[model samples]
Target: MTRRGVIAAVLGSAVAGHIVLGVVAGGAALTAIRAYAAPPAEPVFPAPARPVSPIVSPRWSTERARNDAGEARTVIAALAPLNGRTVADIGAGEGYYEPPLAHAVGRKGHVIAEDIDAATVTRLARRVRPLANVAARLGRPDDAALAPASVDVVLMVHMYHEIGEPYALLWRLRRSLRVGGRIAIVDADRPSGEHGTPPQLLACELGAIGYARTSSRPLGDGVYLAIFEPRALPDTIRVCR
Candidate 1:
């Protein structure tokens, strides 16, 4: 074959290779652009198996329940200004806090006591029957039973971390609060004592869900209380504590 012919063949092959490279590069760039423009997928969280039957038995001792009730009364007193307004207690176990809150809110105000366990809700219903303003509802893993924007305050006491779907629950709680509403999340420094939620992580999660840490106080003997208010809500018109 002639030298010119060989050179011409080499040039043709080089051009074809460049064309292939250009096509591959263009395809990759288009794929990257499409990926960048697409909206992110929603976060997926695992759902634990629900109990076949609700845990109805009182989890706390009678004396312990009384102590908890007393502590709850103090907290409700601190939230005294929210009187005469609708409120929801998320994870209201055994209806311990409902009676005190019911007394605080009086007849005009309502308390929606919610728990994930149906048996607990039944127990709470019976326990709070004397208080006409208290209503018991079963909450789901991802949602509470309260109406959107219907509550003046939402309270979660020593129960936020036990929720399996914390983010989803927080979103639900956020929607439940009224325009000027407040959310008071009270958890012990050690939730379960042995393997409880770390206070710092709780604060971080609450902050992510638009709660501002307003105040904290030591309850007694290694237990600390933290108060958080919704960042989007208006300032407290009347300071209770």
Candidate 2:
């Protein structure tokens, strides 16, 4: 064999011996090789300076109870004139507002029900399967994952406090809103750790990312509605503590 061919043969034999030894050693060597050969896992964005509440459960409360309290109706009313508008329900756990929003928006309009949990997204998809105007999909903790300039209204009901990367999420979500679009948030006036966001803290966090509050009003029972519109983003984001 030529010198090059001889060198190749030796290398091949060494590799073969390594595999044979790996097999004899119960695959530990092979596992180590594979571990080094595998690509790195995807990186996740870090949380902002503020505290993020843990997601306790998918359902905030029973549908019957919320309905009885006129929660959905009040929130829908706060978003007035929903007809022919594209609306997105971010972190849409259990999709409590999908049907009513679908009805309010009419057949000409559309509703996107999005959640971060895969199982929740699957359930939402099944629940809204009959509604032709609604689409259910999965999202990420740090992103809404909606189309650019596609929605006229974004509803974040009882879930804003649980966003892990609130700053990054809101910054990315601004691209999804159309001209004259607004984000409607319904949360309790409490600390984020308590499954609610205080109105002042919410304003500070959103304002840091260039979202201006269009309106803020009480919906009773500790829940409040705050509407925000996107403005020019600052060159550097100043995270709220």
Candidate 3:
């Protein structure tokens, strides 16, 4: 072959060899293209599958659930007997609910005050130290980090909608409940971003998470109480879809 033809042939052969090995060339140099599989496609996160109507705007302060016109009385009425049992107050800001929950659970019982923020947990840990029966725990966006089958009741007061990963969180939370443990939610009937979740949407999410809404009652002032019992959930959650 002519000198130019010989060089072209060699280069062409090099490229053909690479193609046979399944690597694509990117530059004019005859360097071997590393056959790399495209990095595994990123996982697609599940999105809210359905539209559940929500209520309106920044939620009420922790004080709202703490008082809210006898809310403490309302919560006490909704739960199973509080004496001698374990209770979880999720998103337990300022540890406001821990004292009462501890009191209701009695000295024989225990109350776990949980929050996702480390600062919040630190403060809560110190806040509940004097309560004896009350303790603080640090949780995650998708898990409350409570021990398995540890709590008799989970109080999601005014913070259900604030759960950034509700499906995963609730699914995992089922393992934290005792045999007949129950969940309680107290939220306004507004949009979630607005810090509210409508009752119907609340029930749907609970059912999806393998919880059955057993009792629901008006707590007045736009807030309502919902009690749910743990049930068998499917192998995979469908999210809001």
Candidate 4:
């Protein structure tokens, strides 16, 4: 009868069975969940009211050039040690970060490389299949689709500005973080439309969706690395305009 009731009815039916269809939201028919491992009982937040920047390109730079610049190592150093921990590489376009991260995390550690593009995920899966510890999977624009409390660190490199539904995405992503887990985001100091997210705007958007910035620093070449920990989600999340 009410909005919450409708969402509950839709999600509740899915949890009870293998599939559900025709979820109505925002006066439009949304594709129902084909499968759900364990859907959260928490309410889903509305989409952000702000303008989302476009995804300019898949590969920001070549792996050889980035390695020569020591980009991945520098970024990895900003977060807590990854040895024997689980790390999810969000927006893993070409799987550039997989090798270095796999080495850092050690053999006991695990890496989940995710991309929204199905083809990219398939290619990435094949590329990393040789590595015993890394697995590649397709993700969604509004949801990282990570397992709940399964990851120690979530890494987003040069891809934060491309997320269309920041509010909804972050809200869902927060559930994937383990206790004391942190999110690491690397981007440039510029407008999102220009293929970079300004640090202030980034903070505003993340803060609006219940994340606290732990530390941020410039990582040379006009790029920056910011780390955040999840905080309690507010009753209603505000959009950064």
Ranking by TM-score: 4, 2, 3, 1
In candidate 2, which residue pairs clash?
none
- Model 2 sits at a Cα RMSD from the real structure of 16.1
Worst 10 residues of 2 by lDDT: 34-43
Highest-scoring model, lDDT: 2
**Per-model TM values vs. the true structure:** 0.68, 0.80, 0.74, 0.80
Task: Indicate the residue-level lDDT of 127 in model 3.
Answer: 82
Residue-wise lDDT of candidate 2 within 1-241, one digit each (tens)?
9999999999999999998887899765554443223122323434666667888888988888888889889889889899999999998988899999999999999999999999999999999999999999899988889887789999999999989888778877777887778889999999888888999889988887778898999989899999998766655667677
Model 2 spans with C-alpha error above 4 angstroms: 1-46
Instruction: Give the poorly placed runs of model 1, Cα more than 4 Å off.
Output: 1-58, 63-65, 191-195, 232-241
Give the winner by lDDT: 2 or 3.
2
C-alpha lDDT of candidate 4 relative to the true structure: 0.81
User: What are the lDDT figures for the candidates, one per model?
Assistant: 0.68, 0.85, 0.75, 0.81
Residue-level lDDT of model 4, residues 1-241, one tens digit each, is 9999999999888876643332224223211121112234656566655456776666887777898878898888776588999999999987999988898899999999999999888889888988899999898998889988898899999998888887777777877877778889999998887778889889988888678899999888889999987765555677676
Clash pairs, model 4 backbone: none
Residue 76 CA displacement from its true place in model 2, Å: 0.8
Question: Model 3, stretches more than 4 Å misplaced?
Answer: 1-45, 49-68
**Clash totals for all candidate models:** 0, 0, 8, 0
The positional error of residue 10 in candidate 4, measured at the CA in angstroms, is: 55
* RMSD vs true structure, all candidates: 15.9, 16.1, 16.5, 13.3
Model 2, global lDDT: 0.85
Error of 2 at 228 (Å): 0.3
